[model samples]
Target: MGQVERAALETITPYKVEVVQGNFVSKDQIDQLRAGMSRQQVREILGTPLLTDVFHAQRWDYVFTIERQPLAPQRRRMTVFFDDDRFTRLEGDAMPSEQEFVAGLSKPRRNPRQVPLQASEEQLLAAQRDPTEAPPSTRTAPDPAPTRYPPLEP
Candidate 1:
């Protein structure tokens, strides 16, 4: 390849597939874990372990990975160690709150819509009449209707 082609390749970032795999670890799930809790209880809160070693059955690993282009890949690992049948110590990256995690993944709205102001009947009539005047601001403005009718229901 020519020198220019090599330089162009270096400047361009290759596409990477968004990879979301393994267990989705959240703060609420991790909080449910307590010392001396049974392995089944921990499993209920955090779901099935991604890695269960035959050599070390007492420890369970929950791995979460996200791979996206340009941005750095994210990996979260939670290890739950059990002594016999009871849960023991917990270790790994600090889990993010559900709101925080969701917000981080979501992009903010680029263009937001503005709510239109409600116009009174008089204001509407005035607008129709002049087609250029500023809208009336008083709720108690005099009614411009040619005739007012009493409610038949009343």
Candidate 2:
């Protein structure tokens, strides 16, 4: 592409919204899981599972995915295994702590400009006019005579 075309393309990139989907299971929530916990207890801790198959009723899958521009997409999955409707074990990718997950979602802005809450003395003085100067004269016009209207009942 020509230099002008490249420049135009660079200046007019499309905006892509950040998309977060599926269950987000934090490390803390996973830590709460126990080998003998019931399905209800597990649900209360980790929320609803993203995928569950009838053929594999003993397994519950939690998947999380985030797609954001300028950064590579991220996806994580965790599976909870159960026997006789009792929690047995879990297998999946290493999960991030709640703090780390939240922190990773956004980056702090660099060098934010500080705004002054109060005006400086120079600005205050500049806004005020000389005390000795007379204020501008105000002119008032005479009011027109009021009109009389007939009574509606008459």
Candidate 3:
């Protein structure tokens, strides 16, 4: 191979450093997007929505979620409110239906243990002995750690 061809091949190799364009979308661009579009157009661009309204059946909400990735997916939610089979308003935040809210609440969450405060040291020790009783040291944090990290190397 010629010198120029060899150099080109070397530059295009697997281990060669390549410039990658950043995947970034501004908030303005995201805000400009609307929910309602032809099925063909939607499919061509965004594919499908995470969820759709059943009873009301006026809106389709698309949730772009990216997990454990370098760049987070542009969180875009579009709500299309319609009137008499025509698009009326294109918005983001809309009040969830009662069924949706109820379904969300079905998940159980363990309540945190509440420790009592403003009590004497003797009361704290006595309370610690019983599981039901609350401790007295809850009034204030005893030893708070520093907010910043330790000194860095030069």
Off by over 4 Å in 2: 1-12, 108-154
Q: Model 1: runs farther than 4 Å from truth? A: 1-16, 107-154
lDDT of 2 by residue, 1-154 (tens): 9999987786676878889999899999999999999999999999999999899999999999998766668899999999999999999999999898877777445446699889888878766956665543543465987798778996
The C-alpha local distance difference test score for the whole of candidate 3 amounts to 0.49
Pairs in steric clash, model 2: none
After superposition on all CA atoms, how large is the RMSD of candidate 1?
A: 11.5
| Candidate 3 residue spans exceeding 4 A from truth | 1-47, 70-74, 93-154
Instruction: Report the C-alpha displacement of residue 18, candidate 2, in angstroms.
Output: 1.3
Query: After best superposition, candidate 2 residue 60: deviation in angstroms?
Result: 0.3
Model 1 worst lDDT window (10 residues):
131-140
Residues 100-129, model 3: lDDT tens digits: 533533534334458865889887777667
Candidate whose TM-score is highest: 2
For residues 123-148, what per-residue lDDT tens digits would candidate 1 score against the true structure?
77776865555445633566688787
Structure candidate 3, residue pairs in collision = none
Quote each prediction's TM-score: 0.58, 0.65, 0.29
Worst lDDT 10-window in candidate 3: 17-26
